[model samples]
Target chain A: EAGVTQSPTHLIKTRGQQATLRCSPISGHTSVYWYQQALGLGLQFLLWYDEGEERNRGNFPPRFSGRQFPNYSSELNVNALELEDSALYLCASSLGASGGYNEQFFGPGTRLTVL
Target chain B: AQTVTQSQPEMSVQEAETVTLSCTYDTSENNYYLFWYKQPPSRQMILVIRQEAYKQQNATENRFSVNFQKAAKSFSLKISDSQLGDTAMYFCAFTTMEYGNKLVFGAGTILRVKS
Candidate 1:
């Protein structure tokens, strides 16, 4: 089976600009998630969407937001990008509400470079 | 809140040798899940193994296995017959039902397999 796939493998943006990363989940999956992996800060959960609705969000600011499409694809939008925003943004998908035994599958992350 | 920690930032081992990566997590929930993910230079997150908190037996996948200590709250990954393809960044993660299944990740350990 094909794993999750992400687009725009790399992105470059200036301060105060916005960046958008896209992801397509594996077949038969209905949940999408976003995570940010900073150089030294580790991976932080960004957002979670299930069945086309926002289910949960991380400690990140409101500027970091995203949505899941009807087909289970997702897009992460980071507004007012700062130098600190530069990092590897990873997208993952899972089968939701199946007794919570869902294990997530991730895609190739998008490297966002904010100047 | 939950926190995961990987004390070893980097580790190396000869090919075909055995290596272990340590991880510790703090959580108040009685039931949860632990996962190990490998991120290669390609920046794709691949699930290495998983251990459920309530499961007495550890989880194993092919050459990868986990040492889960519930009382001590420790979950470590052990790779047997390591290969060059095992070189990657390994992350320890946690999730609970109350947390809406959002992952709480550790800083990560970089594992390098030597020839």
Candidate 2:
């Protein structure tokens, strides 16, 4: 089966602009997760979407939001992007709830460069 | 809040040698999950190995293995018969149901395997 896939391997945006990154989960997966890997900040959880619902989000600002479609694909939108927002945005997927022992498979990540 | 820490910012190992990356986590949840992810230059996060907190036995996958200490709250990755392909950024992550399945990742350790 195909692993998680992300689009726009690289994206460029300016300060105050908006950016949208997409991710397609693996076949039969129902839970999608978003993460931001920023310099010095490490990999921080952004959002969690399961069964077309927003389950949880990290300490990121409200400007960082996303949604999951019925097909389990997810889209992360960043409004009023800032220079610090430049980072590799990754998407991961799990078979279901991902609460217990489920393993999350990740995508190649989308490198967002904010000027 | 749950936090993961990778003390070694960088490490190197000769081909056919072995190296270990240390990680420590802080969490109050009795049951959770720990994972080791490898990100190569390609920027794809690959699952190296994972261990369930309740499982006493360490997890091993091929040449990669994890030494998990529940009481000490330590989880370290051991790579044996290292190869050049093993050069990458290794991350330690933690997750529990109380956190809605979001992963808390470490700052990451860069491992360089030389021939």
Candidate 3:
């Protein structure tokens, strides 16, 4: 089965410009997650959507936002991007609720380079 | 706020050897989940192994096993008979069993397998 898929694979944006990254979850998965992996930072959770609702979010700024569509695909938007925003953006999908045993499958991340 | 930390920034393992990566997390919640995700040079985030907070028995998958110490909030992954394909970045992550499933990750450990 095809795993989670991310678009562009890589993205480039200038400082103060806005960036949009996309993700398509597995065939039957209902939960989608977003994470940021910077040089020094490991993987920071950004946003999560389940059944078309924003279930939770991390400590990131409001400028970082995303939405899950009816088809379980997701889009992460960063407004007024900063140089510090350059990092690998990862998208993950799970089959069930955020339960302990439900492991998440991740996509080949989108490398965002903010110039 | 929950936080994960990986003290080792880099690790080296000779082929057919064993190497362990350490991770620690801080959380007041009694029930949660822990995970070790491997990102290869291809940049795809893959789940290596997972451990449930309430499970006393350690988790093992193929040549990968986890030594989980709940009291110390310590979770370490050991890869036996390491191969060149193991070279990549290993990230330790955690999430509560709640609805959000927001995963918190550490700084990550870069494992280089020497031939």
Could you give the TM-score of chain B for each candidate, in order? 0.99, 0.98, 0.97
Instruction: Put down candidate 3 lDDT per residue, A31-107, tens digits, no spaces.
Output: 99998988866677899888898888888999999998999999999999999999999999998574344678999
Compose the digit string of candidate 3's lDDT tens values, residues B46-93. 889999888999999999999999999999999999999999999998
Scored on chain A only, each candidate's TM-score is 0.96, 0.97, 0.96
Specify the highest-lDDT model's number: 2
* Model 1: CA > 4 A from native: none
lDDT ranking from best candidate downward = 2, 1, 3
Model 1: CAPRI class: high
Q: For all the predictions, what are the DockQ values? A: 0.84, 0.87, 0.78
Question: lDDT, candidate 2, residue B44?
Answer: 91
lDDT of 2 by residue, A1-115 (tens): 7889999999999999999999999999999999999999899899989899998988999999999998889999999999999999999999888436478899999999999
Query: If ranked by TM-score, best first, what sequence of candidates would result?
Result: 2, 1, 3
Whole-model alpha-carbon lDDT for candidate 3:
0.90
Q: How big is the positional error of residue B95 in model 1, measured in Å on the Cα after superposition?
A: 0.7
Which tens-of-lDDT digit does each residue in A1-115 have in candidate 1? 9999998999999999999999999999998999998987889999999999999899899999888888889999999999999999999899974577598989988999998
Model 2 lDDT tens row, B1-115: 6789899999999999999999999999999999999999999999899898989999999999999999999999999999999999999999887888888999999999888
Q: Residue B39 lDDT in model 3?
A: 87
Residue B30 in candidate 2, Cα distance off native in Å: 1.0
Candidate ranking under DockQ, highest first, comes to 2, 1, 3
